[model samples]
Target: MTQAPKADSAALSTDTANADGTADSGAETGTAAPPRPTPIRGYFERPLFDAEAIRGLQRVGVIDVGSNSVRMVVFDGAARSPAYFYNEKLLCGLGRGLAETGLLNPEGRVRALNAINRFSILAEEMDLTSLTMVATAAVREATDGEAFKTEVEMATGIEMRIIDGEEEARLSAQGVLLGWPGARGLVCDIGGSSMELGEVADNTVGRRATSPLGPFRLQQIKGGKKGLKNHIRETLTELRDKVGGDHKALYLVGGSWRALARLDMERRGYPLTVLHEYEMTPKSIRKTIDWLQDQDLSKLRNRTGTSAERMSLVPLATVVLRQLLHVFRPKRVYVSSYGIREGILFEQMPDDLRACDPLIEASRHLEEASARTPGFGRKLFDFLMPLYRNAPPDRMRLIRAACLLHDVNWRAHPDYRSESCFDTATRANLGGMDHKSRVYLGLALMNRYKNPGSNSRLTPLLSLLDPEDIRHANMLGRAMRFGAMLSVKGPNAAAEMRYYPKKEVLELILDPDRQALFGEVAQQRFSALAKSLGVSTKLRVARTAKLEVAKAELANGEAAKAETSS
Candidate 1:
């Protein structure tokens, strides 16, 4: 775990360093220098949002003034996967009595104001130029909403934008898209006083509809359980007709939905607790809804670590979700941890940033921040491309992500590094990945350190992938294990690999000058990789210049005639 040496900043800027550590300076030679060779970009290096476009968003603060809670989230770090630099929520229940009385709850208003004031002060201390604040449902519908808005402006010097239900729905769907750029289907966001539905497809939000179907509002309805069920059914029926029912997946947003998902996970003893991409089938949802009817909510809350405030709303949300499932009849359901706060950030992003894959971008950011050699992941992916030349686009993205994240846990103790990598791949706040992909990536990373047959404790999770997936994961891990051994600089600096699947041969051609670098450990790992590929291995040594010439000749459809030594 040695640290890479810091480059001389002056030399790094003024002249390019040759492989032999000599400076290439045109002024010293009295002739123009050759153009620098452009580094090969990996599949994950597709065009991203201009760094300058989001420079100011590095430390953005967003306040979501919802009916049930006032939450302030200060996003920092990578724009695509912005870390929660600061996050705090105060349950104000601002829409508690709004259904009975067309006014904001007096007690809830005070709490909401104090919460906003506290967030404003915190933002000032954090040196944020301004905070993006938006209020949903309750505030927009309450009669005194205007007065509260003015009071908030006067007290905290923050102008709160009270968005209509349609806009709120749109933003919530965008937040889903922020985490799942290719997400298509319906987004259902349930707050305290209102529930909004937005349709999404092709990375854009379509029609949106909102209803007074929130728990707080449902509680005020004259009907008991039976009456509430009827109202929910009718409301969702209308919403389905308005928003269309062709959605394949339903993305649940907001606290109550998350609480329901958590309860569902607890009921099923789900292994991976990360909720962003937690999936539930329609049958499972119905069963969980039925299962909730028999359980003691207080005990369930404790077991699932749900707050009393949020858990109290779960029953009403459950009714809505049950009906939502019935009306939409989606093929799948997923819980999205992202909501209006993340949506606010998504709204500010340029189109290019919106288009970037959240998972790959986040992985790239992790590599840049944590890997010993920041850019080695790209080289590793390129080095391994031959093994996966025929892989579909979807699987290729996961392979690319695995390579980028393969070495980020290098500082962990040897005994726990594999487990740590597995945990990170499964539980880290990575977006755009489903549960199965999480396990696949985890298995690959685990294999990066330890060989196969060592993940006994991870057997339950391993069930997520099939035999072919397991084999592919092992091959990826073994390839990385071999490639990482070649050079601390990177695999490309020491050798290049060629894999012939049909012929069952895996060849490693080493740089003649660096052949000594392929010691015992490297050979053993190379043999393991070959074994994983079920191929025979060949080792060759060629001069660096001759290797380059051979590569060019091969590219030009000419036979390479390099001098090789076994």
Candidate 2:
């Protein structure tokens, strides 16, 4: 008999090296085709050829700069799918003891820095181009985070970008799709410091939220409270009622679920302990969760079959799942081997064009997906850029991200999109943020809500902003708001538009016959922003009118040739 030629094992391994659901087959062939890789891997590596290298990245090394753990995972070079990449994790628990203490522990900080240093060296040894170090939750929450971030940069020469929870959740969804193609799954990863949840409607994290309720916090809350279980249940129940239910299939991530599976395996006297190849139903899940919940530290370490290193977190993990189950109530529960780290890796892919900022990126995607017109978004972007030319790079990114996100809510719920954009952009746990960043982006996105004013909370965040940034935001917000107004009035409009500057003033130029909202309130809002930039502005909507006439008078040159020096 002739032997079949080997296809590729590149699809077999991953950072978690979890489950391919065909380990036996994979092992037997040593080089045979994997019947299937996880949907997450395939969903993301679209145009298959574009992602073949994604699986090939097993030799690639990634470091997750998480609040609870600084994990370093490397893939075996031959793995073709992220599902097949073999990787490792280390828990630094940076958020450990930080919630009430109000500071990142020195020990934790040192551990994180050291971990990055080592990971950096490993990445170099591996000669990998795909190395990324990301910080989520704790680092973003820390007061001294910048100092610690700088320490990592100095020590490892890697910039650990602090990201928000929303972006984190989005990326995790991306990675989980590797296994769960096109399924409506509610994915939640409970970390030491935060939990990211995504609702995969139409196989995308179309809506998600990130909260401070990590396993550690959940455990602490359970221990501190009187009616712990009921408290957990009620809190989750209230959360679900308020926010809506998670998908029927609940996907769990982080070490807690992994540990739960191990305990379950021991109870059943399973033959093989390799987790990724493992599967369990709600009956088995509840059984393990119940046992873990009932146990104390002694049992967790000695009898419960959990890693000793993870002993401290088991109680919290149990309560978290317990509460979530009671509240979110999923008919199916699947353990996810992905989280902030994998999410980071998925999003940071060199080819990924998403802005990576939740509010901005989601907003931009929403804007594009929702809009029937093309130039509307570009016109908004072009109109807004000049106003922010003087803003600090950091704030500019946040505000720009908000602007991109502002028009996103137009299609599904136009009336409520401003609020939605504001909520998603601000509250979405996108990593790499400080409170100020969230507040400001939230405020900017919500410009549509309650007229702009100095007395509002978002005002402070905006107050410190470069005067020009305020002007830019104001100008762009007005134009975007107006574009939505006009887009519905029925056809006959310019698709692309821009505003050029003249002596600190801006000239608004739109496509022929574009509608600029007339009458009181809109003009008042528009004028306030224009006035802030020292530019006396007037809207010119008719196309037959010449721009050169305005430009030559106001700028002494064509708006195109005008230089913005000051």
Candidate 3:
């Protein structure tokens, strides 16, 4: 496989921070510059990839020619996480007949080749200096796979890397780790012709095993239910030996599994529709898979809004999933929207690039692209630091992220900014966040715009948070609201905050020149900040240094005269 020049996965968004402390309105680059890693109190920080890696080739692209879909994804800039600049997929079942004929489907092959040619032209038009094409499963198993690879290269001037099952499993597992840096469990990646299982822990890939358990393969099994069961059980024996029947988590990768999870979401009326990181307990998944066995899949297709072709494979995939849960008894099953493309992206990233914090880099990217003042996010954070003086390291990072993103959504319609802000934080393809932390950030952003009413639709996600978390979110929001308004003249113009915990007083000391800008609305926001802090508020004009300097000079003159007279 050819390695593309590793593009630093920094924020690709062209939101440049200007010298005047304002965000420049450049074309939105899908990437952002990451925040410098400062060693937070009581926490260790790792350096990020050097800027030189991303300097020449800021954007990279990959074409994934898979069994079920032939797609092209352009990742802009670089960072530990993927920032998609362009993505397109064509569902051509290139592996549709591989099980029966041991050859790529004739019609599907034509469609895939045409798609590849078009993708090649598009990549050329886009001038993707670092583009790589990878083919999986179907191509690997097909009788004329090498000839097909040759044809593709001759026609498109691009050599496709046909990855074998083991490499495929390794890349899929790496994708899981890319999204979940702390993932410690099994990764089940289902494809058209095969399913690959691998173990990952402590940020490293572990044992890997591949099986002919894909839905397409199951469709061609000699036996029906019994045979399918026997085949799955027999095939997974090696996997069982390697991974054991322990209750570790299982990270699901593949379109079919995500479709199944989406169906479950529809069946349960789940509020958040974001698929990546969507988790289900073994019992819940078992129930859903069992229930799927009886439901009218046609109607289920309509309800869940999944394609018929995709739904057709659900039952087969469900059987495999059921057996997976029963055999592995995983504690939880998480779906990853990222797979080979993301893994390809991850493979190119330098170690420092892989270590950068995903959430902060993303927020900083948004701030650079959309905020009225880019640098003010840091100012706002510093201004409110007194409020979070004792915040734990994790809490402090979240706060800093919230501050950076405080104004990124202002471009949203005034009526929808709050909800939009919440959705952006919770649903964006951010890394290193759990469901609870995602909701917490969303709620904080929601409150940053306006108070969340009791009956807000967002209340369902609140189940993940307690009162203290909500209170803390509100404090950050209120502080952001005040700081935002105060920093309209840039961060330097914002008033300094002084907190006296014993006195229970929160003071806003304004520069005299900036006093007029502090008006009724500002006062109201300051009061809200004080209320959130459970403290009394004081608004004072700071004394000028010139007066103190003159007084000291006069005293010095008097002292000199006294000495001379003596």
Candidate 4:
């Protein structure tokens, strides 16, 4: 395969060209060109990506030429939780008739070429030197696939890599791991021409296998539904044998699965619309699949805003899913918005970069970009650590993420900042967050601005969390609210908080020089925090001596007073 040339530094220069396409050289102008400013690194000027890991690249683009659609995605910002800087897709149906004929669909080929051409131009305009293009089952298995690849390169000067079935399965599973570093399951990705099954566990892809069970290929099977059912059953059984059936969860990837997940959400009247990390049970999936058979798909399509092309494949995909549930018997099912494209990005990440939590990285990026004090989130987390001393690792990560994102929404209007924070936490494109974690984080941020009442509009989302989670969220929020009042500089600058849980006392040791910062509002917020913890508030001024010395003196004085009273 021919590799695209590396980006030329001169191509990114500010120098202008003349009308005749000749460069206006400084030598010819008899004047020196001004020096260029240093470029800001990372997304929103945050240095999240290691300079060596990405080879000093700021942005990367990937093109997926699948059986049903062709999509071009340009990823920017943090590599772990990359932002979709530019995304466009066309339902080209490149494998619509591949089952009948050994060649790509004539019309679909034309559309795919046109889409790729436009993507090529867009990449050039965006100053991307190369795009990593991958062609899946449709093109890889077609008779004219290599010829079509040659034509694409001739037309757009972009080489397309035709990956094999196992590679495709591996990449799809890796995509799931990009968002869920600790995911352990069977990843089922259904495209227009084929379906792949890959086992993932312990942050790596295990056994992988591909089958001719795609909807389009199933459509060509004789004997109608009965024949299709038998074919699917046999195919899935073989896949199960090859990949094993020990997986407890099934991670669904690709458009057809996402469409099914969306319909499941609509049927259940789920409040949150965000699709990534949306979980479904085997029973719920069975119910939704049955219900989909009777509903008017056209009306449902319009209501759910699903494209006609994607909806057309849903029925066939649903049949596969039904058989899949029966054969695999997975305890849980999850929909992943990440796919082979994200997997390609993950493939390039270094081991250390891959080890970082996507949610924390994304939250840090948000704080750096929008918070009043960029580094205050870490300080806030430390100040509140006394409250969560025994928190589990999972809970600790969420608390850390909440601290990082606590003040990113301070720019919203005062009346709606709480709601804005809630919406952002619940809907933002942060990976590694499940539905429940989202609500918990959102509630914590909501309480950061104001007390959430029973009649709050976001009350419905509270159902996802139990009483304990809700209580924890409130305490965390009130802790942040009180901590923020301590200093505009940061929480650490104004006071040190010490919670004596056994004594039922929440103590605030104020800095002698910063005593003026403890205003009426600060005191009220402190009281609210103490009330939430069912503890009394204790205020003390720190002496110029060490904190341990002050604590010793106070303890001795209390002990002496108790002895004298006795």
* The best candidate in terms of lDDT: 4
Ranking by lDDT: 4, 1, 3, 2
Cα shift from native, residue 555, model 3 (Å)? 30
For each candidate, the alpha-carbon lDDT, in order, equals 0.76, 0.53, 0.73, 0.78
CA deviation > 4 Å runs, candidate 4: 1-52, 547-566
Predicted candidate 4 versus true structure: per-residue lDDT over 1-566, tens digit per residue: 22333332222111110000000000101121111112123212233463454644456678889998999887783367766778889999999999999889999999999999998888888876345788999999999999999999898877788877888888888888878777788988889999888888767888889998888898899988998899899899989999998778888888888888888888988777677777888888889999998999999999888999999999999899999999999877878888787777676566666767777778887887799877678768878988899987678878888999999999999999999999888888787778778888999999999987999889987877779889999999999998877887666567789999999999998878778899999999999999999999899988757655644554575466457546
Q: For model 3, what is the error of residue 205's alpha carbon versus the real structure, in angstroms, after optimal superposition?
A: 1.8
Of the pair 1 and 3, which is ahead by lDDT?
1
Shift of residue 489 alpha carbon in model 1, Å: 2.4
**Cα lDDT tens digits for candidate 2, 315-419:** 667667767876777766655554544444444333332212222333344444455642244444444565556656565556555545555555546566565
Q: What are the models' TM-scores? A: 0.87, 0.50, 0.85, 0.88
Q: Taking the tens digit of each residue's C-alpha lDDT, what string does model 3 give over 1-566?
A: 22253332221111110000000000001222111233322211211322566544466778888888889988776666567778888889998978889999899899999999998888888878578788888999999888899999999878788877777787778777776666777888898888888787766677777788888888888887899888887777667896566637787888888888888777677667777777777777777887887889999888877888888888889888888877788777777777767776677666655656666766777776789876567767777888888888678878988988898898899888999999888877666666667777888888888997888878887766778888888888888887888746443354678898789999987777667778898889989888988999887877867434534554575466457546
**Candidate 2 TM-score, true structure as reference:** 0.50
lDDT of 1 at 416: 88
Task: List, residue by residue over 446-502, the lDDT tens digit for candidate 1.
Answer: 999986474478877776677898898888888888887788766766778888888
Ten-residue region with minimum lDDT total, candidate 1 = 17-26
Best prediction by TM-score = 4
